[model samples]
Target: MGVTKPFPASVPLSSRAYIDRMDAGLTSVAGAQEIISMISSRRIVTKLILGHNELSDNGCIVLFKFLGSAIGRKYQITEISLNSNSIGNRGLLAISDYLQGNTVLKELFLQDNNFSEDPEVFITFIRALNASHLEVLSLTTNRNLSDPFAETFLPILETPHLRELHLSAIGLTPQSGSPLVAYISSPRCRLQTLKCNGNSLGFRAVKSIIRAIERHNFSLLTVELHANHLVGPVSSDNTSEEDGDEETGGPASPDAWKASETQIRRVLFRNSHLKRETEKEAIRLFRYARPLLLCSSKHANAPAPSTSTRCTDCSCSEIPSPNAPEPEPDTPASNRPPVEGIFPFHALPTELQLYTLSFLAPSLSPAQRSRIYNFASSPSTLPRLGLCLPSFSSNSRNTCVLDPASMPFGLNANTMSPGGGCAGGKCAGSKNSVLCHKEKQRGEWLAVVGCSAYDPYREGEGEGVGEAGILPETGGAV
Candidate 1:
């Protein structure tokens, strides 16, 4: 027994040497805590890698307490990676407080630490971090969130100079996080990189964010959102009813809202000249003129979806209009998802879509509503946005499938309908007046257009030539 003696590895001299390569295999929060005491004894330890360990808030606190002390001040610890841990809002809250106090520490890696994405945690912590000089914050795999913060971490929005923000796999639906949508539209944010993949930010959010980035002058380059269900995983048979063609690509419903801030950002960014540009600005100004209600809770629960937009088989042949851009291999459809901006469009309740299209009518904002209105209303001056206009499918050139309703501007179905008219203005009388009826009647006019122009998606094929009428509410729930 007297033959051997072991040197304490935690002693500052040896610990400092080992700290440089400190790969402590502390497994759980408990293990991490037990080793904290040993590590705390060292005076010069700077970097710590507790990755692949299950360190929770309690365990991290033990380390944070010491780090927050005079010992922590002595060391210029800059990096911390807490990978593989269930550190939710509570843990993030603790870290946020610690971060506010410790400005020396920069580059915090909270990856795999299940941080609570509640709007409060994000907002409060970010606001509290007014003293934080830290940059490069990563919160991956911490899904559980609601509302605004669920899809996007609002705290990062506050960081004026912070460079990178990674929020991959944060639990959310394509429709979630409108608050952040509003935030991104704000001209104040100064973020460079935003990486959100493996989460459901939806096609609409993706397009909205991208367009906003390009419009707002954010120094951003990378955008990722995959693996999460953007297009509802539906079988050929199990299709959504909203996809039906009843509303002529979903009428512009009352709930439809224009991405006004985004439009304003676009106008501010792009030096517009054409009718489309002026009309776009004018319509956006009209929408923004009316203020929106401030959203409080991040996951403040809202009413569930009353209906969803489903695909309708309208005009399976010929391009709906010449406005849609043809998909090319070299196009952004290359690295970017083809259906990226599509989720919000699909998420558009059938009724909302209709209303959007109606206001999209060839009215005061005809040039602006080109994508939403009757083809005639759209200005010849405004060149088509590649996406808004329909395209012939690659699968079969002769058999063209058009997403004619895929317009950048929103069209609420409620306002666009002509009561019983089809050609952009009010229907004079007989069912012939309604576009729906014309399609059903197989009139020479609709026949001339092949229903592609009137029933772009072919939503009402089965409804049989009924007069233009309000679609009967199909008791569906989201």
Candidate 2:
């Protein structure tokens, strides 16, 4: 056996120590132990850099113990850099326990470590994150962050003071979409920079993030999505499908994805103060995804009507008094008779009208749908029609018109109402499968009745309808 040397004397402690790149000389736990002894004596080192030393968990644990001790608690460390040191979970757990009581630490760099060896230990470290004052946490390549670990960690990643989150190349997949989106879209999220480069987050994950950014008004400065599986060269027209080459692992018909991407780009690039490099990266990430095409004069806004006056002869109105005379030739169009067989739906009370329409909606015959479409679409009928239209909810995303003639995605009334049986304007469920039928119809009822003629996507409108009752360019049943 080789002769052992006496322990090295501890150097006088200062506010900072940069012991990086000393792997060739001091390559043992003895170095970490000396540093720990100095710290345990409350030597007042506020910054420590032990990077590139290859000091494995054994050496790191010495530092961890020093960090957790009562004297170590007296010494406030504001920054620590243990990158590329091969520190594993055991050392990380010790560090986590130390962090619980240490309040001054604001930055940590644990890149290229072995934290992924046991995700539970990393989770324990994350749990301690709530107690620490960390502003910058970089875990660039702990490849063990698979679906399970991500799910556990994402809920805890909502630290409001965390300004920059570097999660690039951590083995994230599409399964991380929902939780990630929920966190990014949350109002409490104050993260300004989110780096998610070099992961397998496909179109689904990208699309969800894009939608969340727009729908939830995310304020992130920049989101790095470089070198992932979001296969692009997206199509020109909104209708063209994405190429589904198995080699690239891309799916077909990426219109929705393209739309969402374009919207994200718009939001990110809207601010004029962003740096040129950030704008360039935004462009590069969404090069294939086109910007939103502006509508022409054909989609110009129309002023809504000033007043809504119900027609006397419309079927929705209660029977007129016998003494009421017919309208003179000079009567305004709003007082004229409605189209034949079309109910004066606007004449009824709002709630009663909605209930009546919902009752009639399930089994609308082709002829009835046509008549309803004609009356609702007419500019002359819009003044009165505006009175009864559903006030659209901002939260609803699945708005679709109930017209049988213009149903999208090849849908039709036959498919919508398989076994129609609304004989007396009431959609009473049959006895055999009443529960199942009612459950199925419940979704459709909400979809149809909750839709509004003023929806942003309605064919004739520029964007959204206001209270002015301006008729859209395209009119159809709600």
Candidate 3:
């Protein structure tokens, strides 16, 4: 029995402790207990590396038991490495139990351990990992994990948090390749790096893997398949009709393998480009959609308008100024009706809202844009009309004529202005009518109806038109 050295006091409490292969004697159970006790005492230790120390099942049990204890739970250890430690079924079961409730641990490296001694223990450990917060798991060089590995571990591919997986040098055969192909081809696969080197994968299996990677997977960055049985004659028993040339039952040509590899490289390169583009597009979309999201969130949280107090009048005579103070509601603010047009404005789907905003973004000024956003976000009961265009009839002379009934008030041909500037006669003196600057330059009539309150027949209004009147030449002789 080697004497165990005391853990260095000079090491900071928060720093990772690398005690693997240090000759500090962690091979025996007593040595493992001492080190674990030391680690448990320092609650700040976040990473414990003890690979290649030959910590057999006995020693690992002591370490894992300490990890599962109430006192061990206090340590902020996010990572633990115990590779080549000679750990067996008991130690794995202990680690599996520890992992079930552990949320802080993100990485666990148990490569080259004695997991093959009892395949059931390996399966149990993997199942426990599905519930844990582990992001990176490396279980390489644990031989004889052939078909069972595929059956037990394929479901773990759906785990959202797992990003990198290393299962190289495992005793995986061609039979284990199809399941791997299926899992990697799935949309739920989030693995970024996959290393499966030094396995007994044949040409068909490697080809299938390449095909899946090229066709379905865009997230995998690195796929290592070195030292595998990629070249050589494939057996008909191992092949399916999907191989296209399975009837021939011969080795895949060198050109075919080379072409597959080239396609893989091209596809991976494309994935990289697509990933960058996707990130850029996401950021751009978020920037553009932030206002809409905020508006939606505010609307969602805002009190539902009381139907009893809802204003039936949806028309707004005038656009309210952004700075204008909202009038006090007859009922409480919670019971107050939403502002005019707000219901329809917010009724649009989020995508449509984004589309509308993007379409109007180029034309709207900063102040105007801000006012629009404020109107969407604010719960004010101010009446405001959304932007709309009025329909008008045009003559062969390129003159615009307004419909009499379409006007806010009654109109006759005599009341129509000789100058074809606005649809409802000359709007030069009308406060509610605004002339289109662009149309005015071209000597054409175009009127933007600001409000529906402009009545020509009012008491203080100008002279009324008679019934027996002819439309003006500029008014298109209506």
lDDT of 2 by residue, 1-478 (tens): 9999999977753323443333443344886876676565544467777677766788887777767777666666777887777878877887888776455888888877777545677577877886666778887887766656667877776454466778888887767766778787665455667788887776656666766765553346567766556444532222112323232333534564455556666866642233233223322222211111110111224343433344343223233224544345354333456678986544444345433443333333223222333333333432243222221432111122233333457765445432233322223333332233333433222222212111112233222111223233122211
Instruction: Report the number of the highest-TM-score candidate.
Output: 3
Each model's number of backbone clashes? Answer: 51, 5, 0
Clash count (model 3, backbone only):
0
RMSD of each: 27.6, 26.1, 25.8
- By summed lDDT, the worst window of 10 consecutive residues in model 2 runs over 289-298
CA lDDT scores, all candidates in order? 0.45, 0.52, 0.59
lDDT of 1 at 195: 65
Which candidate would rank higher by lDDT, 1 or 3?
3
Give me the overall lDDT of model 1. 0.45
Pairs that clash in candidate 3: none
lDDT of 2 at 435: 33
As a TM-score, model 2 comes out at 0.46
lDDT of 3 by residue, 1-478 (tens): 9999998777643244443333455785986877777785553667777877777888887888887888888786788888878887788888899988577898889888777645577567767877676889988998856668766778554555577899898877777777888888775566778888888776677777877887677668778876666445554335232667432566666676677678778877876766554333333333454455454645344663332222122321343335544334333333445688565544566556655764444322233233334333433322223222222222112334443445556565445543333544444423344443324322211011100011112232321111212212112111
Q: Which candidate's lDDT is highest?
A: 3
